[model samples]
Target: MAQLLKRTHMCGVLRAENAGEKVVLNGWIAKQRDKGGIIFADLRDKTGIVQLTFDEGVPEDVFSLAQTLRGEYVIGAAGTVRERSAKNPDLPTGDIEILVEKLVIYSKAETPPIYIKDDDNVDDNLRLKYRYLDLRKLKMQRNLSFRHRIAKVTRDYFDQNGFTEVETPMLVRSTPEGARDYLVPSRVNRGQFYALPQSPQLFKQLLMVGGTDRYIQIVKCFRDEDLRADRQPEFTQIDMEMSFVDVDDVLAIQEGYLATLFREVMGVEIQLPLPRLTWDEAMERYGSDKPDTRFGFELKCLNQIPCVKDTEFMVFRNALDNGGDVRGICIDGGSKAFSRKDIDKLTEQTKAYGAKGVIWIRKEEDGYKSSVNKFFAPEQLAEITEVFDAQAGDLILIVADKPKVVFDSLGFLRRHIAGLLGLLDNKQFNLLWVVDFPMFEMDDEDGTMKAMHHPFTHPKEEDIPMLDTDPLSVKADAYDIVLNGVELGGGSIRIHDSELQAKMFDILGISKEESQKKFGFLLEAFRYGTPPHGGIAYGLDRMVMLLAGESSIREVMAFPKNQNAQCMVSDAPNAVDTAQLAELGIGLCDE
Candidate 1:
């Protein structure tokens, strides 16, 4: 028979004010300490922990049973709240203790593999395998609580702004959205499959077509892409869309929502009207579309530097002649911090990003020391030093390569150097909107134009003509919200005209038949007077991760798949019965 004990208050709810009042508490024993005459135990619930005391005044049997209480044992206690002999300044309910007169041990637990405290420092794999036990840690509890609060705030803010919460189908048709799809074979429809949505993108757009003026969905999304610290195979997105809106309108609503969210959740006031930068400007200044504005080591074009014209150095001259760029960043006080060996290590790191080599110059008291000093005369070095305004302790690092390689190599190097110097402050968040992204990019592998965001993104009105003549030069009316160097979310005004949508498909080399076969529903819906609509999807997992100050999204998620996309706790991605595969008309391929 199950023992039932009525509960009046949570373990952590008792305070000094509740002294002398009878109370019943139910929770797990966090720890137990027996001192011959009395037993003291820490009782913990989801809220927090409170100490329970069983003194000599209590019945002998109850006192003896309290001594046997071990960590994580579920118990119920009827007691009187009283002032503690020694107050624990660290805990919220530390000023009071419970004098237990009755106790019931509901369930006994074996010792947990991981400790039920913050800062356990257990291996990630072991913690994940015993996730339920791991989640009992205070840090994990706080992280999940923060995530819930954010979601609630998001809902309230959006709902108050007249957005309807709508659900889109999970088992959706697979359309190429850059990432590979996680496909599910349908047993009823033999040989046919359904793919989980990477985002509720098309559905949200269709909602605008279906006359839903404002829509929002906090939904799960799936992808088959490689994982990273901030990424997972399956994640959540706070997706939204609005009809009859321009770029400015969408930005205004999002900015307002963010301001409210930060203020309410973190109690930090976010300055309204966040800064904006064009994609070209961001790349030119920071060598990255998602620029980390927290520190300043902005890239400088060496060709624009006064000394490059007079230099006889073949590295810079050959790069310009071969249609490549010569770019460098001046690291403040880098000369004293980095030795020649450190510079050599940096040169090797650049090679990983496709740069052939890195040129380093150090400004010293006597003269400048450089890898290319032999190629340039004293006057040229002097002019170069003046160009960079190099001080005695400064170091200049340069890369000469094709534009893509130069930007990729130097941009990453800039961040790496900042990390080494401890210049990035995680406590500070710098947010900006990167707008006016290029409509298309030329794929290096196939030499074909691909949509930078998606084919549905509408090009700038004035750049529409360029689509026919110089498609690569056309800019989309797109925007991305970036925070501390990471892209938080992105969206663009979508193509509402059927003809323009078809034209976009044509530019991507999708034939009429193929377009009709794959995106026929969207095209057909567009024919029925689609409204001008656009929306953005924020990675909920990533957002929570940033808010909780966690390096990985897995920390915020309850049961996330590991780097290999395997669920450690459930041991998923396991083999199914032969009958199940046969039912679906599927056979294993013998490789």
Candidate 2:
């Protein structure tokens, strides 16, 4: 049976003001120190730790019982608080120590496989295996607490704004729009399965049809796609929707939420309405859709350069004649940092992303030096350097290829170079909206046009007519919220008109029968008079990771799966009994 007495004070609450008061404390033993007749143990709870001393003055039995205590032993102590002679200013409860008059050992624990300290150097896989103990670490505790605070604040903010928190169905029909679905086989309905939602996109739109004006939910979404460092098989999204909202209205509410969140979470005051960057400007300036504007290595297009009129370097001239682009970036003070060998390494890195070769230019005290200089005279190098305002210590890196390859390869190199130079400011967050995204992109493998976002994303009203004539020039009403070059979330106004939706399907090569087969229910719902609505879904796990200042979501999660989406703690997604599968009329096919 457990002790009848409940805890009167927390481990961190017995300060100098409560020095002479009697208090009952309950916690796990953090550390035990023995000093002849006196034994001191640091008792720790979720709040913090406090020192508990069992002395020879009052109870000899208590002092002897304290000697048996070890790390992580759960105990209940009734003690009188006293000021310590030598106060340890490092701890919050350092000024006062608890003098125990009673001690009750609630539970005895075996030595933990991993240390409970914050700085324990255990392997990550081992940590995941012993995740319960890993979560006992102070960092994980703080992370969970911070996440709760943010969630509470978010809910309150949306609620106050007349947004009704609503839930959508998780088990629905599968539609191949984005990531692969996680399907669940049903025993009651044999040969049928329900797919977990990648997002509540269609349901939320149906909510608009049902006249649920504003809907919000901190919902869990699942996808059966391959995971990356920043992705998970299942994750939470701050899903929201609203009726009669334009792009500006959505941005305004989000901006207000950001201002409050940054102020409360990080204690940083953010200015209202973060900057906006167009797709064309963002790609041309930073060679990325989500540009990191924290530093200043902007991509420079050399279409204006006049030195390649009769150059022997066909790479440069051919790119211009073939309707491709020549772009470069000036790395500040890289003339000395990158040796010839280092430049060769950089060239190899870009080649992975499909660049044929890299052009290197070093501005020296003598004259302009370049890898392609043997093919061009000093005068040509001077003309190229002058275009980029190259100083004596600057290094210019150029890529001459198709516009797509040039942007992709050089953009990757720019980020790599920035990391090598430690140009990212960890303390600074550059948030911006990358607006006016292209409606469709040509799939290289299939040579077919695919939606940049989802197919349901509505094209700009002005571009609606262009769908029939010039589909490539159309822009969607999509907006991506990017934080320091990482895309945090993206959304767009959805197609509400059945006529326009049919037209969109035609453009995407979705036949009438195919569209009806996949999205007939959604089209049927749209016929019930849907309102003009749009919403955004932010990755809640990633957002909390950013707020907690952690590198990955695993740190913020209590029991997270590894990169392969395997649960080390519970050993989930394991093989079940063959009889159970047979009962469901399912057979395992050999790969």
Candidate 3:
């Protein structure tokens, strides 16, 4: 017969209040020290860590077993909680010590390759490879726990607001209009494949048409796109959709959901009805649709500045003459923060975003120094200073290029400067809603109109007439919720009217047969009286990453792919047997 060991308390839960109380605890031995006559072990669980003492009072056999413990060995100890002589203020259960009388080794573990500490500076590849051991660290455990709490809070809040959690199929037809899909081969249906969903988009819309008024799903979405710190090939989305709701209705519900989430998970109260900005205003002022309003260093178009158009500086003159933009941002105290060499590095950074070069003006004690001082006279320099409202010890960085390049380059530079200045506060959470985006944006390579959000996004009712005449002038009833500078997620009031949907497809160069072939079912469903629906999908991983104060979504995800979209731990995307491929009517192609 096997002996069963029962746990009466977590390793970190016993405190001075529980002094002299008998308790049984089970956890991994974080660290152990033997002081000749006594042994002390720091036992750790998911909650936290507590000290266990094995002295002469303990049974000789139990004390002998406890002294043999190593860093991550799974063990259980039965003991009485007592006030510690040397209490640790850093830990929660630091005030108490467990006088362990009974000890049992549940399992033994080899020494971990990486130290199980929050500040362990191991290589990310090693961390991912030994993710199971990495997750034993307190920080990683808390992040996953926080993720769980957020998911629970989201489900509860949406359910209370009359939303049903309906599941959608994972394997579906490939719609390669947006991000590249991760296709799965179909063995039964030879030569055909099913692509994993980028989002539960069409199915949720179909649900709305089927009279499922309010739908919510915590679902996985796949995308074979480039990876980043905040992105993964496969991720979870807190997706929701509703019928007969406009922009305001969807925004209000989401605001309520977020408010509840913050209160429950973070214990921080967020003010209802977050700040809102229109797409044009956001882009014009901040040079970005997703603006980080945490700090100030807003972009100012130099077209409005006096003497800019009249200046002999060919950079500004040629830009204004050729219908390009000249924009500048005033970085306070940047004169000292960024040296000349640092400014050159920033100039190189801007080139990556399509800018020819960046012009920098430093406000000195006497007057001003500029990269293009030879082109502008002292009086013209003073005018430039006045335009940017420059004070002594400030730096004005300017970019002159086509509208998109100017915006992209300056926008990225602004954030980079903020990071250099240490002005971005991780503790401060700024939520914003950017609305009224253009219905279509011109693809730089092909010069063809592409849907700004997606083809399903409805054009502003008043701008429907301009779909064929001037598609670029049309605005979509779309909105994006931005946190700090990262875009959390976005959605738009979908085109429920069949004619409007067809017109949108036509504008995007989707012919009748192409539309039928790609989204024929969606079009067919829309013909059955679809409601005016709108909803948003929040990147659950990104949301948790922000909430947990992590720099990457991988910190919050259990198993994630590396930059190359390869799973180092599992070694996935491996070769399959030839018989399996042959049975599926698939053949390998020569590289």
Candidate 4:
């Protein structure tokens, strides 16, 4: 029988200082080699890996037991620490190895479905199903450790900054608006449902009212929305709310947090008060509100080009006449890069996003070459090319449609095309505050205007008067932090006055009674003298993914659900028993 032992040192903790001292180590066997007379085993734990060697001369029984060890078999070794005969320069514990005089095989493990190594070849579903084993891999373990460090640093920073970490409710009354809610039927209160929070928006505001002053919670929020590579049904948000704060105050506090966070998490000091770009400026330059500013392929407006009216290109003329837009970006040395087939496929993708088509102008060795150039004579082509400052080997891709479609298509294309050309440098950290978003956006279906951020976001003071007139022209105090074309988080100074809140609801097409029904308590609280409040919530998982240099948020998560929102490991979202369903007075309608 194997002897029980107490561990004096971790497998990865031995060094030259303890060379003459005896120690005990415990870990799983990462690898084992048998050369008949002598056996060697590399033991691995979460900390790192260490090697153990057993020779017949040291102990015949220990050598005999070491020979029985296999990969992933749990074991304990008690021996005198010694210098390694063959030093492994690559390993952390390379200079030292344990010379085993005592060996204990604790438990044996079967072959794992997935290899406990980085770059293991296993299907994602299978890996998730055996996430415990998958997490045992060095890469996954490192990701988790990095995530924990970031989280700890963030919490500590906030705590130092006079913010209180509070826990909010997971089950609350369903007050639906933004995304579909995940409802849980309450057995105690029949037919009534409790919805998982899409966010702690309302509760955070209430906390401000309750005088929490500065509140932060690393909380789990749920949204029943379509999943993407970066999205999961249940995800964590580093939520925060502050009372008696204006836009500047909120930004200042956040900038301090970010400076500390970046220094702690990435070892890179981010300069405080990062650059800010107005929503219009960002969209006009990169065709995206969340523009990746690491590379330059800025959008150039051709709406003022004189030939646009007389070009005879119907797409261009119709768009110009219909109060739409014509914009394009000059790709550096792209003339020879994209062929006709490639441009056609780009046009197809733009069309899917509602753009009519894409037009291209190439500056060749001689002159301008374009499919639409037939409509423009030499003089006109020359004038248009001159406006764009065309150069040899340069390609100009243009889109003409409604302003929205034009921006959306070219914006997505700029990033996509830049990625294809390897123009974006991921090593650079680019942070921009996109502010001055329009207060309301027109719904294409009914032309009804709705708040761009949310109804509670306070409109800019000057634009507040325009709420009764051109609401669409009004801008809000909202700002989003964009990093590499991803909106990391967003928040706004809220409308705390009850009258303003009611006015916002009116503009959003929610009636007085309707507002009361959905947000009656909040409206009532606002009447009791609420302070100026604002807050932001960051996608903590995505933030950790960036810190870990990971491609997907799933890599940073321990046991994330798949794209379909089902947990392969836990088998969550599974069907309940028929008797339980009957108790809830519900049954599937389908046959």
Candidate 5:
């Protein structure tokens, strides 16, 4: 073996200015090319990649070793940085190349199952199955680096803001936070299980009660739920809680952090305070609380339009007669865009959101065309179009159903159409706070009221009186930070008063006994002196996805599970040994 080179500089740090300087670089070979007279290779590290040169002037042993270099071979090289004869304009260190004096092959790699290049068009499963190789790509390395910077920024900002970085228990008593809990069985205590913390919600609040006025933690949380592009069974949260604060106080703190983050990470300066949208207004205008404001096509209510209201069209009639709402959006210059087949596809998409069908009115050069043309005369259709403020070369899509269905269907339709039209720009960050959410939502299956956030969330002071009388009309003192149509984070003033907390449980149909059994500890803690505190938690994975210009959170994660929540690399959720299961007093059901 040759004498090893003591590392001096990173591959990406050497450029034309560092010419003639002795340097040592350690990295995996990105690619290697051998000309008859010389051998050139691109060496890559987390920072970036740089080119290395080996010609006949180099030692015979060094030249022979360089010739054997293959992709992903980890090697160390001692060389002098020199100006490159042919420069690559795209690379940061393109102006210079390394003239290898000595080389050591640290490790050799086999042919990777997947290509390491970012533009490699391969199936996602193959990429995930070989994640170690996949993460070697420059794109993946940059994303992970971006995530790290965000975490550092979060800690620094919070520390400067008087927040104490606190650690919370990962294992805790099972308490529902909307999703099913990922439970762990006890070996010591048979039949008892500890659930993973879905978020540091309760523990952070407890810290506030314990006189930790401000707390912050970048913590891991877990949930036993179905997965999607932006979700994982186990994920990290920028968890936080603060004492002596209202909704505005928490929002202000988050805004400061976000402003600092965006300016530093994305080089985008955010205006001091982001916009705020009331929940009711957002639903009515955009059909979504986390509405994307980058594009037009705001939803409009068609219930009051005379042609739509009094038309006697069976669909419209049933919706209005039953006190349901009818809402729509007009897409400019989309008249001929959606053909009958396209409209049918739109209907199929809306059906998943509980909408029976979609009604569209397209004003073409000739005349008005619609799905409801038979039910209404030509003039009436024109009147309906006029109400929607739609002109020729315009389209009006309407959903007539219950208010929930209308909002869900139309909200999704707007974003879907925007995507097709190339309007939702990932680089354009549109952030706002969605406030004044309803205190509770009705669960149709059992006709019961469930907390929109959690039972511990406090109701607005004025709305507290109405909670007993009209729970549906009451509002929670909660706020959600929305970015680009996604709920980035949310928090609320907690019900610190034990009496109020008990009342909340009662209203949610939890019997006093059931409440004591499930959330007895939280209720017990509330008995002590508790401060007025609120906090917010950001989905760190989702935040990185937005800033990294990636569509899926998997791109930003180091190791991510598939849609079925299975880790392809580790193969988790596999059967446990019978002895281990027996120790926990568990049994597996036969398939």
Candidate 6:
């Protein structure tokens, strides 16, 4: 615990220019080797790794101490920087080596379960269980450092743009925000509970009413939901809200932020005024709201084709008879790529997305080979390829189902097939603004109309009339920022009028009393002249993950929960003591 020598230089920064300089470095011993009575080891700090040399020139005790070094041993080495006899072209500090004069052991470490190397190929659970050691890897350290830089850039960009940083409550009243809330039972108010904020959705809007013109917060939000690569139970959001701003104003400010963030952090320039696609157009063309425009598997409707519409084939005929449509996507050169067994496997996977089956046609060199050639004439098969301009070496995949299912099937198929073909490139950035989302969508199970976004999103001015007659046909003043195929974030022009707010609640099947019971504070605040405010919240984890070209947000997070929402390192979500539960007037239920 005694201080021997203070760190004079980082391990990675000792360059050839700094030869003859006496420096002290504190770090873990990454590797150790003894060749011809000279001890050489790689010393690592957060900055980087450098070679440390201990020869017969050092004192007997110092050389004896250097011999004990091993991987992950915490130590301090005071030495003179000199030119390396053998240079490692792979390292930044490769041209120089530290010749040790004194040494001190801070702590000895056991052999780590997980290797402190980037390409170890260790098991996921083992890496998580020993995350502290895993983080020592250069890749993880770089990922965390990159994340820190992103946070700093986010704060700097918003602050320079006249936005006030505001902190909101962690524990607040819970309204239905689509996702389930993680509730904390109150001990003081027996049997009462405080729900974690799904977002600062209501509070941010209330800030607008309180006359805060521009607000920003890199805030934490919670959602008790299913976990995936991108979804975490607890996550951070680069949340912002603005008062007296329309869609254009909010979007312009956001684009400016993106320009600044990408240019500074990634050294990439994002072109101004990003491309846009309406919700309808996105679904019709790509069959997805968050359309990945990097590839060309665009969906084409087969219902209007004369041969397909009039075909006696049950797959097409039955779907058309029941108000459904037939649609397909053409894959260039896919005829040679997909075998019948491969197509069958893909067909099975589409069933999980509610597709009945897949109908395929391969345009060969000689003629067209079709799955439904028995039903359709040769001319009809030729017309199928004509619909997609599909030439020889092209494969057309068709899905016949209800419009929604049909679109959903093709949406997933395009992306899945693209992945199989290695067509999605992370280096290629495709930023798009998806706007004019539907105000309401019919719930498949209940057959009731639910708000496509939340209820507070302002309805399109012209579509307000349809709230009484056809609310599902109405659109909202909402926009989502999408990258590749992922929806990075979304915002809407909030309903500022109380009457309109009430109409939204009513249309979503919430009664007058029920609305007051849930969102009374927000409803009451809106009565006193709320502004035409709009806001967006970006998933900070997702942003950093994408920036780092990582498949999972877990790679960027310091301590992330596993697939079942349990922390492997800390063994979180464990049972609490009975007294603690009793104090909160709660009892355990059988699992």
Q: What lDDT tens digits, residue by residue, belong to model 4 across residues 82-104?
A: 89888999888898888888888
Task: State model 5's lDDT.
Answer: 0.90
Could you tell me how far off, in angstroms, the CA of residue 298 lies in candidate 6 after the best superposition?
0.7
Q: Give residue 14's lDDT in candidate 2 (0 to 100).
A: 71
lDDT at 485, model 3: 92
For residues 1-591, write the lDDT of model 6, one tens digit per residue: 856679898887779999999999999999999886899989998879999999999999999988889999999989899998889899999999999999999999999888888899998888888999889888888899999999999899888988999999998987899899999988899989899999999999889999988999999999999999999999999999999988889999999988898899899998999998999999999999999999998999989899988888888999999999899999999999999999999999999889989999999888878788899887888888898999899999999989998988999999999999999998888899999999999998999989898999998899999999988899999999999899889999999998888889888999999999999998998888887999898989999999899999999998888898989999999999999998889998889
Worst 10 residues of 3 by lDDT: 1-10
Displacement of residue 454 (Cα, Å) in model 4 is 1.5
lDDT of each: 0.90, 0.88, 0.91, 0.87, 0.90, 0.91
Candidate topping lDDT = 6
Candidate 3: tens digits of C-alpha lDDT, residues 505-567: 888899999999999999998887888999899999999999888999999999899998989
List candidate 2 stretches off by more than 4 Å: 12-18, 87-90, 308-310
Give me the displacement of residue 24 in model 3, in angstroms: 0.8
Q: Mind giving the per-residue lDDT tens digits that candidate 1 earns over 1-591?
A: 437689999776778899999999998899999988889999988778999999989988889889899999999999899999899999999899999999999999998888888788888888888999888776888889999999999999999999999999999998888999999999889999999998888899999999999999899999999989998999999999999999999999999999998899988888989999999999888889999999988888878665675455777777887888888888999999999999999999989889999998888888888998788766777776676677888999989888989898889988999999998897888889999999999999999989999999999999999989999999999999999888999999999998898899999999999999888889989988999999888988898998788999989999988888888999989999999999999999989
lDDT tens per residue, model 2, 422-486? 99776898899999999999999999998999888889999998999999999989898988888
Which 10-residue window of candidate 4 scores lowest in summed lDDT? Answer: 378-387
Residue 547, candidate 6: Cα error in Å is 1.0
Least lDDT summed over 10 consecutive residues: which range in candidate 6? 1-10
Tell me which of candidates 4 and 5 scores higher on TM-score.
Answer: 5
Work out the TM-score per prediction: 0.96, 0.95, 0.98, 0.96, 0.97, 0.98
- Candidate 3 local accuracy as lDDT? 0.91
Each prediction's number of clashing residue pairs: 0, 0, 0, 0, 0, 0
List of clashing residue pairs for candidate 5: none
Q: Which is superior by TM-score, 2 or 3? A: 3
